[model samples]
Target: MNRLALLLAGSAVLAVATITPASASTASAGEVDTVTSCGNSGLQSGLSTRLCAEVTGTTVEFYGTVGLAGPPSPGGPGPAPKELITTLSTEVVGSGAAPTQQIAHVLFTSANLQVRGSAATVPCGSTVRATFGVASFPWAPRPVAHEVVITC
Candidate 1:
């Protein structure tokens, strides 16, 4: 009877292992490529800068934010002024040396906080690459570093 019981226990353990779901092989959050800074050429106001990176076999997304530098003008009295102004935009360019097609373009507005945009189903086989840029409308006197984020 003890031998039968031991066999049953072993069989149950094997059954459980077989039924368990296997771990997925997809890439982790950190595997995606990201670019935080581009040399010393700071992004100018009213000018679009390029955020470029190579991405293969995964989707890529972009995010940005603008922070105010200082308080509003002192002369103003009627309305309290807000300092920081933020905006973000994104576009995907193919990787080939002479590629002529754009994968996607996304525009984000203040209404959409955090300015999250994404391009999915990008060419997966080769080393896919893309570039995006950001700029202010009227060029703020004290420009702040715009926070950018990316995910795959």
Candidate 2:
């Protein structure tokens, strides 16, 4: 009787352990990252924003903000506050296939914004790549853009 009771208890514990639920996981709608560079002659500054992600479907969406900081003029004062230069939002589609690279749309939110050239795109994976030079400033060292690259 004692042996049978012990066996039943062990079996019950095993059953409970096996039937335990798994923890949940979270997924992002997309991912975004930024890169920035300082300006020359205190005229303009350089900034670059890059976003990449993969989705099952042909379309992907991106949203984020880009900012710039400038040092005070020579013999002036400390660095100035960071300024919000742009709020970016766009939908990109693949050229074709499981992995494709496409240049997403770009928008300038700041009234004083000045861009150099144009944005470029590169593929990183089945659903990921990078976009460069989305926006540029007149006083900045060079042109800049908020590039969005997507895969999968």
Candidate 3:
């Protein structure tokens, strides 16, 4: 009886030890690591844009903000704060696959508006390859996108 019990207990322990790692690996197969990137507006002065992105297993986070990059001009931010519209987007690339993308629009009212963000975090089924964060500032002549790249 003692031998049988000992053998059964040892087998159970061995089975558990082996099973645990497999389950852990299976769970982590869909896990995503932290990926971060940042971008800056191409503006010279006055109101400027700063954008960043963080990609995780379940969500892609955007940190887009508008503030004073340099000394303000004699005039205020713009003809209209409503016109101070900004666009932030992300191309999250993982495991050599096509990038999952999301975009958000933000309006900068004043320097007090610290952070503007987007709610797009489509789960990546594999490890992250890279995260590309793009910010578009509404300039006079034409709008251009500035990109920040982050690889994991």
Candidate 4:
């Protein structure tokens, strides 16, 4: 009887091990995952920014510029002049499944910028990356603020 019990236990253990995938057992409940994307102006004529993030465990605090476009014609087909501005700021926070896309809009003097992207669900820490450039509107033509990337 003892020998039979030992054989059955060993076979059951082996069967369970074979049925499980390696990733499941290797990843602990405390482990975290991340998602990322790049900011770009696919929808040109104005500013388009991509907000990307890497969500760690749970509860993440992240900050980033949604979108930026540039050098608008002094007077041409573009955003209304009154919308042009020297600076812009935006914010967002929430939780859900993983890899949910988020969208935001930024208005500048000569152009309108749209930000579209995703963020990680909460309980997980979030890391953000952003890019900014000189306003597309005409000004003193200060140094062209090429692509600026900041990590938050």
Highest TM-score: give the candidate number. Answer: 3
Query: For residues 1-152, what per-residue lDDT tens digits would candidate 2 score against the true structure?
Result: 99999999999999987787543233345744343322222222343333333232333333232333433357866344333343233323364534223333444433233322223343444222323233243332222233333433
Local error of candidate 3 at residue 120 (angstroms): 3.7
User: How many angstroms is residue 141 displaced in model 3 relative to the true structure, after the best TM-score fit?
Assistant: 7.9
Give the winner by TM-score: 3 or 4: 3
Off by over 4 Å in 2: 1-44, 54-59, 64-79, 87-152
* TM-score list, all predictions: 0.30, 0.29, 0.40, 0.26
Residues 52-126, model 1: lDDT tens digits: 332333554444432223344478652222223433333334333452222323333222223344544454443
Most accurate candidate by lDDT: 3
TM-score of 4: 0.26
Ranking by TM-score: 3, 1, 2, 4
Model 3: per-residue Cα lDDT over 73-96, one tens digit each: 566554344434344434544435
Give the lDDT of residue 42 in candidate 3: 40
Clashing pairs in 1: 49-133, 51-132, 68-84
The true-versus-predicted C-alpha distance at residue 52 of model 1, in Å, is 10
Cα deviation of 112, candidate 3, in Å: 4.4
Candidate 1, which ten residues in sequence have the lowest lDDT sum?
141-150
